[model samples]
Target: MSATRRQMLARTGAAGAGIAFTGAISELFAGTAAAHGRAGYGPLVPDPKGLLDLPKGFRYQVLSREGENLRSGEGKVPSNHDGMAAFGGKRGGVHLVRNHENRVTAKIGVPTVKGLTYDPAAKGGCTALALDRRNNVIGERVAIAGTAVNCAGGPTPWNTWLTCEETEDKAGTNGYTKDHGFIFEVDPVDPHRTGAEPLTAMGRFQHEAVAVDPRRGVVYETEDAFQKPFGLFYRFLPKKPQGGRGSLRAGGRLQAMRVPGIPDLSSIQEIGASFDGVEWVDVPDPLAVRTPIRHQDFGPKGVTHAQKLEGCYWGGSSVYFVSSFARKAEGSAGDHYGQIWRYDPSRRRLTLVIVFGPSTDIQLPGESPDNICLAPAGGLMVCEDGGGVQHVYGVTRRGDVYAMARNRQNIGTPDNPEWGEFAGAAFSPDHDTMYVNCYAPGTTFAVTGPWHR
Candidate 1:
């Protein structure tokens, strides 16, 4: 590890909310004209492989590619690779559990096996991969099957992965025989033991992502609906997560967040404006049959609104979440790329750590910050799901944002490349490899470099 990185971790503790208050581009990425790259580790050198472009000393290799046969050889690797989590393998290397955000009529889905599915009619689920310490894929298989829109999820300190359904589709709705929109757990310690069960107590809404507090077993959830109606920031205090892996199913209390004095907190349009003394409102019924739990159950009860709460991560002792693209288009009051908020459970305080305003520049320091992973070296690595050319932004505990890697791949055409949204950004437990997914064509890359530098 570099001395510079060690100092950053020691000075700014991740346990509490720390942020770099500057909007300046990362000095590390200021590229010189001759090298066609920026400072930091050096400007990103264009990849001759035409997959990913990285800085001078760094390189990336495709870990998993779409259209490939599964390790079990039942179905092809599902497309629409969304959120993911990385864990230290039981034997060696890294174990990553990934989510496939498939819909009912999707062409590719998780392999359906007997005695291991929730709703066979549902097409979305999660898959697990085992990679060697060299970042080579050793094995891959389905972890959880038969769910819907398995979007973003977080890894538990207990060595399991929590995969969430982003849909509120009920059993009878859209040909689904079973109700959807619930959180599912996948144990990497034993993949076959991962059954098709939803943590129903978490609530049924347009679920986005979840962050589990390692100490208290409190699960922080985000809702991803349109902005006008907005979504709620939720917390599920598992009654007995002490039972381990599937304990959340034992039942828990579900609640929505509220700013003490604000009815619609989504409209608060200020960067770095802190809201202390955050309160929680209990939700009477989390499983809504006729309407979404957010629209009908909590809207009228003064629960605060968040335009589109997407990716969230639990680290140190707080939950960090991204409100992606809050604009009038999504029904939110104002327009901006995104906002990052931190909620400290112990203090009951919520801080607006970082906000990205309007920007057309593809190389801007901060864009749409989504899908966050707190690296072991200390600092948040964010996935960008916004428009234009995209890159993963590295954030300090104090909220200083910098360009870590840029996407130079061509999707639409060579003349007009649309950098697809970056998702599933997680660093390996050893900190030697960082795995992230490109939404289009569904590609997962193993990134390694002097991350400590």
Candidate 2:
């Protein structure tokens, strides 16, 4: 490794020691390296030649493409697809709910919803597709009414998908008079006829994803803001008892996490420390209900920020979060390395699971680990959000890394390209099939594996 990278590893090791121990650091490095080396032997699938690489015996077919005519005959194809969730309907068909993370791009087509155009220049939105057992599209519907930059979100236990808008604006001209960031719930089967009002009770922030604890009605949320000193991490507790569902706007208690033991390193030393655990602080009223301007009160010490926290999931009795743009040393340009953190609600503890960056021994060249999905066999599938040679990677709980699929056919310019990999990674209810979405080409894929690993 390079000298700079070695130094980075040393610093990361020290941080890891502070969080857990040096032994954990060694295991993290060794496990990831070992996993990458053994990737080719784990599972074999017959992947498409020259399109992307996969294990032997795995095959994929196109499910939906941008601008393709659906049951509604809406238009050609949608663009900037991101997070997705799959639900099995009573009719034995699977319903895939997807997010379109479109920015201010005019080339991508927008949904035809009246008074629901959040941004005139916004191209991406959210859609739900009903697929038969054979993975064919039975129907399609646009769920959320008006929103922009719809990023990665999680599925609720109540059988509803939470779609998050990842934009925070000072000037609210983008069809969002209330706030730029919020979460919306949509029924996968009936997307077009969604409720008129949004679930505003789920605090307003630059939301990236939401993970709900099935036992507790507590919802964990991640933020993707960095323009300020610290980005915020939040948890919402519904006021009503468990098993109650209607709209997120009904009522809930919003609270921000505060790492008290670890000082605010950015302000004091111009560098943040790599601490492992976090403490929670309740924020009674995020948006002052009494005021018409909708001002947010972040409490006294304010919110503690981390690297750009993008994707999150609830697993192993803890919530896992990924920092896409983690700093290498104290003061360095954001590196490609990302770190996965596990937050245990039972113990109220935060643990640093693994760190990914060029500085570390194991490196992933991707810019951001946008969205993540767990495998029934015990591992994670991450969506790459960098440029050139994008792919979908599988990582084990033991820190093993493998490149499961690549987007060779989806390589082109940012806009108006043949294929560009995005997010929306979901597994079928039976865990027998995998589904993925491409943003540049605006398409979805259904793949079947031979299961003889």
Candidate 3:
């Protein structure tokens, strides 16, 4: 998904994927608010390492580097590391599940396992890295294979990853024998030995990410489709996801979000738009072999649609998701940088939490939030995949945004941005270290500092 995840957001002289980057270009250290507004994590000090620039007193360690051979000896390190999450492990160690969003090609691809292969011809899947307390990788291997476009997935309290497929490829295409676009579970402890079976009950679409409500076992999904057809926000009510390994495999009701007052949530121009309770109407045929799931099912129920639903994570009793960019041409009244919304299940209300304005330049802190993860320091952290110098932004508990880290790696790239789009920015369970991905020449960094508690 190099084109879908990174190039799509940064493409300006192009259109078609998601939002195009027609804005002016500027240097990373030139803009005021664009470079970084305030000292939320203290001012970013240029790094001597030349890989990443962090704030004063903060430093980063490389956990995994692309181009290195895989631990499983399956293939070289996978690129386009998109969505990821951290889990607790032995004696302060952590188990990190990373997603490789590579497309199908013959020679180069992500590693695949025999029994767990979904599409032998496909290359997209995920890997699990075992890191010790000091934040050093102890093990790394292909966790899930045969899936297509493993963009992002949520970690379950049951200690598993629900890796998602961002492509809607069918069987017999590109040498594929199985229909793609479904979620699969991977065990963090035994990622290489987990099940690759698609959670078919949870509709098949161009899925981006998922947020699991640990308390209810309900899985909320975000679709990364275009506005012409519009993407649908869905939830899966697993019949037996009562914190078990094969729980979601039981299959349950799949439904789309229907806001009672807002017919099309994307059309609302307001920043802090609010909507009373949402309805979840059943999606009769989620397999979507013939009819697209959003059109035939969601359209009939008048389910509210968003521009391009991307990152989704469960935190603070709410499922926070990203709607990358909305424009008037796409039926929305006005064009905005992007929006982040929080859906509170208990209150049964959805609140717009964050929104980005038009970028002054295609540079470092440009908006269009993609993958999101909770900072160990009590706030939300978003990976910027929009045009400009990509970064991983931090959102305070009080709603203040700050530039946490800048993509200062791969200094010799031909790309104007120079740095790769940030992905998989997640913190360890111990709250001592946070991990991030530099997309293309895939690199994973473990950053630690005096994080705000």
Best-fitting candidate, scored by lDDT: 3
- Winner on lDDT between 2 and 3 is 3
Cα lDDT tens digits for candidate 3, 26-131: 1111211221333267656888877788888888888787779887687788777878888999999999888988887523467777776778788888888998
TM-score of 2: 0.80
Task: Please provide, for model 1 over 1-453, each residue's C-alpha lDDT reduced to its tens digit, 9 standing for 90 to 100.
Answer: 221221111112322222333221122122211111222455567788778877778888887877898887767888778898888875568888889998987768788876568898888898888888888888888888888999898877788888889888877887889989888888874666768777888888889898878778788999988635788899998889664877888899999898877655556645456787898888878888666766665545477887778988765567788887676765666665677777887788777655664444555445567787765444567787766878776665344345677776667877776767789998887677789998767788999987765
lDDT of 2 by residue, 299-378 (tens): 56555667577888876467777776555364323443566666778777665555553422222333457788865455
> What TM-score goes with each of the models?
0.88, 0.80, 0.87
Q: Candidates 2 and 3: which is better by TM-score?
A: 3
Worst 10 residues of 1 by lDDT: 3-12
The RMSD of every model to the true structure, in order and in angstroms, is: 6.4, 5.9, 7.9
CA error at residue 142 for candidate 2, angstroms: 1.5
- Quote the lDDT for 214 in model 3: 85
Q: What is the lDDT of residue 21 in candidate 1?
A: 33
lDDT (C-alpha) at residue 131 in model 1:
86
lDDT of each: 0.74, 0.63, 0.75
